[model samples]
Target: MELSEISKSEIEQEIQQSFEGLVEASKALDATRYFEFIDAERFVGLNADGTNWNSIVGLRELVEPGFNAVEKVESLIFTNVRISVIDLNTAILVNEYEQKILLKGGTHYKEAGGGTQVWSKASGKWLLVSISASSKP
Candidate 1:
């Protein structure tokens, strides 16, 4: 659908709901659901400095490691989300999130970051095509 034809309010709602789905998928480590918000055929991710993940399917492999690493975390929380719809088919979402990770010996680490997701409409659903994040310094 063209951006001009879609309502801004509707687009904003879709973006917000899509991000919530992403958070749920992350906390559950459900790759299937995670991929649901992504356009598997055209998804692309870039880290800071413009380095690509090398391949679309490579996302699963990269995220799997982090999922395993966070398995011990006691909790993950997403907060302070702000979403802006650039157009009907695109949006930029920013959010601050924290995770409380527990390790052996009662050690704990709190990780936080600001994330950006670029969403696009494909096949009648919003799919996240690009994502980038930076640690809170």
Candidate 2:
């Protein structure tokens, strides 16, 4: 269905569910599952520190290393999520969340902050197009 035909609540709910699936994939360190939710052909991610991934391959490279380095991870917690439709086929989602990571040597760290993501409709599916995010150490 077109974005114009989709209600705001429906979009919000889809975003929430997609976000939850992402968290689950990350917590499981499942690369295959994680990439399934993204728009591989038109994806970009910018870190808070000015780092950027310009393509799906770049995103995968960045994510895999971290997941491989970590021994375990807790599911991310998203809160205060907000979504704004940008146009007939695009929307933006912002939310605050916390992440905990346990490294191979038993080192644990936690971060809290939020991220903004751009979601685009492609072939009748909502796919993540871009993201800008940061969290405190």
Candidate 3:
């Protein structure tokens, strides 16, 4: 899919939904659905440094570790969601989120800020291409 072919509103909605899906997939440990939103052909995930997972099969390595971590948690929440469409087929999304992890008991991690996710259109659908997160100031 090309940028000119997609509607601005559609891009906005897809971007928002994608982040929501991230939160849902994380909390539920739904690796399959999470991978569906990723653009495997050109995926760049940056948590610490530059990392590339340019194939769906390669992404499994990234997804599994996250799913495993969240699986041990009891609940997760994503709040203060804000999304912006950069063009017809690209957007950025941010949110303040928290996760309640239950291991021996329960621990909470709260942040007043969120992350930036870059999305693109592919195969007539929107898929996330990059993600950069930051801690609250």
Candidate with the greatest lDDT versus the true structure: 2
Residues 18-121 of candidate 1: C-alpha lDDT, one tens digit per residue: 88888888878777788788877777777644567655667777776656655475778877888788776678887788888765556678878777888888
Best to worst by TM-score, what's the order?
Answer: 2, 1, 3
List TM-scores for all candidates, in order: 0.80, 0.86, 0.71
List where candidate 3 sits over 4 angstroms from the true fold.
1-7, 48-62, 70-72, 104-113
Task: Evaluate all candidate structures by whole-model CA lDDT and list the values in order.
Answer: 0.76, 0.81, 0.67
lDDT of 3 by residue, 9-103 (tens): 66677677767777777767888778788887787765523454445555577668756654265656667777777776667776666655644
Instruction: Give the 10-residue window scoring lowest on summed lDDT in candidate 3.
Output: 103-112
RMSD of each: 3.0, 2.6, 4.2
Candidate 2 per-residue lDDT over residues 1-137, each given as its tens digit: 44554577677777768877877888899988888889998999997777888888878877888888989885467767888876656789898988778889999988898889898887477788998988766
Better of 2 and 3 by lDDT: 2
Q: What overall lDDT, based on C-alpha atoms, would model 2 receive against the true structure?
A: 0.81
Worst 10 residues of 1 by lDDT: 47-56
Rank the candidate models, highest lDDT first.
Answer: 2, 1, 3
